[model samples]
Target: MKDILSVKARLGLGFGSLFLLVLIISAISIFSLSDANNRFFRYVDGIGKRKELSSELLLAAQQRAVSARNLVLINSSTVRVDEKNIVNNAHRKVGELLRELTASVEAMSPGEERVEAQRLISDIQQIESLYGPVALNIVDLALNGDKDAAVVKINNDCEPLLRKLVEVVTKFIALEEQTSAANVMHSQDEYELQRNQLIAFCLVAAIIALALTLVITRGLDRALGTEPSILSGIAQRIASGDIRAIDEIKTARPGSVLASFGQMQASLSALISEVHNSSNVISGSAQELSAATEQTRMGVSQQRLEIDQVATAIHEMAATVMEVAHNSESAANAAATADQQAQTGGVTAKQAVAQIEHLATEVSNTSQAMLRLKQESEHIEGVLNVIKSVADQTNLLALNAAIEAARAGEAGRGFAVVADEVRNLARHTQGATQEIETLIASLRNISEDAVERMEVCRGLTDKAVLQISDTDVSVTAITTMISNIQEMVRQIATAGEEQSAVAEEISRSVTRVRDISDQSAASSEHTAASSMSLAKLGGTLKQQLERFQI
Candidate 1:
């Protein structure tokens, strides 16, 4: 039973050891790849989850901010209505609504919205501060606590201020919505892409592991059968104190009983012929196995060399990724700066537009004044016409008096000359007044035309100012969007740099595995080919062994 166990153990151990080695190598490969895949999946999931959360938070914050701004606009309009009517009902409604808005905003998480929302809130608070004091004053005046003049002052002062607040709040709402939408879209896209990539990587890795297990098992079975024949021959020769002539044994086919018998006979013949020298063929087979091992070692060395090269490449890739990340961060910062500058520019443009509007208004007033002057000139011209009419009448009266003097003959001669001179003087006065009236009419027409031209210019200036205001708003919105995009890009770049660095490390690792795998594959192919050659040689030896009488 021990002897049977020994024989079975020898055969089983040899086969099992080789099989186990193959399984161990395959397991190592599979495990390493599985670990890498798991890590990648986890990383992707973690990043994606964070991005999704950020997007959700950002959207919520943006919505809250928009809602707050809208409420502010509503509040402003309410205040305006209150001012216009000087009513208790409007005031109470506005106050109630304002309180509700504040409560709603406070209910929402302030931290989620961050500084932009806070800034918008601050703007609203500032407006409220101004409005609150003015509202109280208006209320006091409306209740007859102050003079009617104070109520008029409140109406006059508060309307324009409230209108300005309304405009600002409306703008803030628009900006918040725009940024929020973009951020949400980008984050969703990135998360989906990461999920897909991880899935693909995992699927591919699983397929490769199954293939490696099959090939290794086949090699072990063939090697096991050959071990017993060689061992039996060596054992017999050693026991008999003979030199083993085991050349045919070295060349025998695996699992051939005839070859095993021939190898046993040859060892017995060697024991009888010579005392203690084994055949050189065992050394040759050992040399062949050593050569195969050396080839595998060379393959491993080559694998290591390739791995080093890959590691270098990965290092370079990592560096490049890091640079890209840095550039993205810089770009984001630059965009933020640009956004700030654009906001400033928008403000400047708004001021310029306001100045232009003011200039246009001043021009309109100047044109109106010119028109008034022209009307005054026309009035003067009318007076001059009246004076001309009176002068003409005086000339006619003088002519009639001259005619009367002529009727009195030589006694009226002196009077006639005087009357003629008086008529002439009146005629000259009338002509001069007529000329002055004509000049004044011409001047009045020119002034009217100038006023009309100035009005046209003022209209054009108003249109231009309005256009500039719209453009300023558009530029501000674009700048804000760009700034948000830049910030997102910076975050993406940072993630990309980290991913690239990880990819580089993974690539290096993969390359090392690939190189080792390639070398192992190469050696395995060579080994398979050599095993075939060995099998062929063993067949020849079996044929040769058949000729020997065992």
Candidate 2:
């Protein structure tokens, strides 16, 4: 237990032992006081009380005997009655005293003192029993006016019984005195015994306290490996940051507090020296890192500016491509409109060729009417009128075609001029038909000569029909070529739009790159500032480490 016990445990054990000893001493004192108090009470309630009651019993017996004698002698009735009451009262008092003495004797311990006291009490009671009735009978005899008989009985029975009762009462008194003396001696002896025992225990407690003090003092010295005052001084020095080596620590016991303090001082000195050197290196490295970060920030800033300029140039190029695509789209729409107008002009040329063929048929009828003028000269006049009407209709159709061609814009301008020439030819044909009508009266005399003219007119109408077919073919070819040109223009516009979109995408990518470069530049500035701060903190750490002595 001593091997495992700490300094606190040893101190606690010493204090607890001292407390237990104090408790034992207090208990001994309490027991001694309690015994003395019990002895005093026993004297008062038992032997002492019994002694007083026994003396009273003796006095009552004597008082009753005297009162009984007075009852026989008194002659007045009032005096006799007073004597009788005195006798009864004295007798009753004797009985009360006897009972009280018997109880007190019974309360005593069952030893020789108690046995002798009990024997005396019993004798008093027996003698009182005999004497009490005799005394009372004498009073009765005296109260009845029989004084002679009461005197004779008093001498024969009352005197002898009373003498025996008095003797017992006197012996009981003596026994109570002897018991009271013995009890006083016993109380004194007990008080002396408790006092001696308390003194002896106190001596033992003093010795134990002295021994515990020596043992705890030696154990604490071994645990601390030094004097408490010396150890406190060393701790104060360490707390004040004085880490210098101590000469006394070499003599301290192994595994002791002083030895640990010595080891801690050595380890701390080495650690502080190493930390001081590291702080210098850290400060130099941080300064170099700060310079490098500043250079990186400058490069990032330049890169961001270059990327922004590139993005602006790409945006302008994309706008130019968009304009070119719009122009191509407009050209495609104009080509499509020109193709539709050429197709309409081809349909009008076919109508003009059909009207000329109808004019040729009417001329054929006039030639037949002239060949039969001697028999059908009236039919010749009707045919000439029909040819003039057909020519006027052809002129009107050509004029309508020319108006439509004019409405067809620049693509239809050449077709409009050709329609105007056809209209003028139709008007000339109409004038020729009118001339034939006027010469019809002359042709009835020369109708056989007009047949060759009708054949030449049919040949011209067939040549005009062939020329109109060639015009339709030319119009169809022009329309097809224009349609192909429109498709190519539309494709070119679409390609130009695609190229503009690609340029726009390039511009957006460059914008993102510029944004990223700007962020990088900002980050580089932050890193440079942080490196400078770190260098300052390292210098501060170096200063802090210098405070500890190595």
Provide the lowest-lDDT 10-residue window in model 1: 273-282
Identify the candidate with maximal TM-score. Answer: 2
Residue ranges of candidate 1 with Cα displaced over 4 Å: 1-410, 500-550
lDDT (tens digit, per residue) of candidate 1 on 95-190: 454454444444433454434544665676677567545655654453443445554654575565566556555654554455456445655675
Stretches of model 2 off by over 4 angstroms after superposition: 155-160, 274-546
Per-model TM values vs. the true structure? 0.26, 0.51
Candidate 1: the clashing residue pairs are: 243-277
What is each predicted model's overall lDDT from 0 to 1? 0.57, 0.76
Please, what are the lDDT tens digits per residue for candidate 2 over residues 1-550? 3258877898899889888988988887898789788867768567667767877888888888898998887788767788888888998898888888888788888899888878887787777778888898898888888889999999999889888887877787787788778887888888888889888988998998898889888888888899888888988887777889977898998877899889988988887777766675565556556655676767677776767767776776667676666767666676766666676667667766776876677687776766666445565566566676667677776776767676787757667666766767666676767666666657655665566566667776776777677677767767776776767676766767666666776777676766777666666665665566575556578667656765
